[model samples]
Target: MFISVVIPTYNRKPILEKCLKALEKQEFNDDIIRNYEVVLVDDGSTDGTLEWLEKNKEKFTHVSCFSQNHLGPAAARNLGVTKANGDIIIFIDSDLVVTETFLQCHADALIKGEKKLGSDRLFTYGAVINTCNFDDPTSEPYKITDFSAAYFATGNVAIARKWLEKAGLFDTRFQLYGWEDLELGVRLKQLDLKLIKCPEAVGYHWHPPFNLGQIPNLIDKEIQRGRMGVLFYEKHPTFEVRLMIQMTLLHRILWGILSLGGILNERTLAPILQWLINQGKPQLALEIARIFLNWYNVQGVYSAYRDMVKN
Candidate 1:
């Protein structure tokens, strides 16, 4: 079976090169690799990324490069999927390095029927290994799982093309970052599709510390996260059982209060708080407000009271 590897990249040229080299070393049979195609979606990077891809196109015959305007990673991935010609689709971030057995392990799982879910085939599974140190003797490898709300790490997973078609692709409305994966995972669960945690299918994620100047962007991320929280609760109200989902709005409120107290590191909380406050309490809005304020043992009584009056 052909495996389509979709890699979404921004301006990280060095990291992208590392991931490509690892792909070149897959231990899977030559026939599989020959059948497999690597689709690189460049999300309108200004770092000469397109030129680089053009220059290196000869290195891999199966590598297909595509470019689009400055859309987010989620949109870029959807574009890649449209161009893919494989039965199974594997998504690996441009910042990760895979083991030689990466493809082989996931393929084996599917073929042997070792992992599945309900009446649907088990298509999606996690494969990221995030560690503090890459070479430290004491640093052990980490595997991604859905044991908790924070389980689905980034885009280092594989899924069947049919599954993507059935469950829908990544939500493009999540313009920039955060919560898109969680939203997808939630949808998969609702569809009764199992997302297994395959430790043997491993890859190392190289995440560097953000620079101080990137704080604004980080805050913008949190704001987008808060917005996603709003959408998430609207879609899956049952997600209240998940701590991350439960605390979604409250987390923003807490951060705002903490910022006011001069104890928080992020500065974008104030704007986010102001935005949420302006969203006026509909019934669901009032519920979220009460939940947000109640988490801090604050008086949500007035907001609830106001909501009742308005309604």
Candidate 2:
């Protein structure tokens, strides 16, 4: 099958160049795979991603660029899928630098899964290793925190285009920050689609090292994720959805105690977090910051749920 590696990018030109380069170097020539195209949908980036792509057009031989207003990733991905010319759709983020055999691994796994399951009702989920090493993202080793139990995430996953269309693409109303991908996963689950883990299709997800400077944006993202999570629950309205959104009493109490009832917030924990950063432990600092971050999410989820109830 022809493959489309669809990536929805925001203002991430530097890593995006790396992402495209890696995809261009893929070694995919299996019987199940024909050829691949990189469908890059820019979500109205201010960082001149399009211009950079134009300048380095010769570098990326397999990329087809598209753009839309800053309508968030859901809309961007929808546009990418619509414009794609492949039967197999591989969803990955622009910051994820993949290995040369990434596509091959996914293709092999898909074929094996179909044969074993007696049907093509399956998708392949790849491993995502988070890293702060921009110079060589793939050099970073996997950590426990990188272990995700998510059934489906847009980070590194491949599925047939027909399944996505049948399940209905992401809800554009999740215009905030998160849960658009997993919401679609829920629908795919209802269609009896199984997830086959493909660990060989590794992608290193790169982000900047944690610092006090990033606290505001990070917190804002959690809140936005919470709001969008409420939209996810509204669409499904199941106990599992509530648990996933952290909208339940257990999550509320857990985060409340962990954050010391919201008193251990960014301002109060600044010294500790800064100390951890100064000690060259940004990862630990980020983990500590998650205390208040999770509190904000639980609060935001409940607040949105309350607003929905009132309306």
Highest TM-score among the candidates is held by which one?
2
Q: Which RMSD values do the candidates have, in order?
A: 9.7, 0.8
Q: Write the per-residue lDDT of candidate 2 for residues 1-311, one digit (tens) a residue.
A: 89999999999999998999999888856566788899999999998999999999999989999999999999999999999999999999999999999999999999999999999999999999999999999999989999999998999999999999999898899899999999999999999999999999999999999999999999999999999999999999999999999999999899999989999999999999999999999999999999999999999998898899999
- Rate residue 309 of model 2 by lDDT: 91
What's the distance in Å from true for residue 45, model 1? 0.5
C-alpha TM-score for every candidate: 0.73, 0.99
Give me the candidate number with maximum lDDT: 2
Per-model C-alpha lDDT, please? 0.64, 0.95
**Collision count for each candidate, in order:** 0, 0
**Per-residue lDDT tens digits of candidate 1, residues 20-104?**
7778777875453346788989998999888987888777676888989878888988999999998888988887778878888
Clashing pairs in 1: none
lDDT for model 2: 0.95
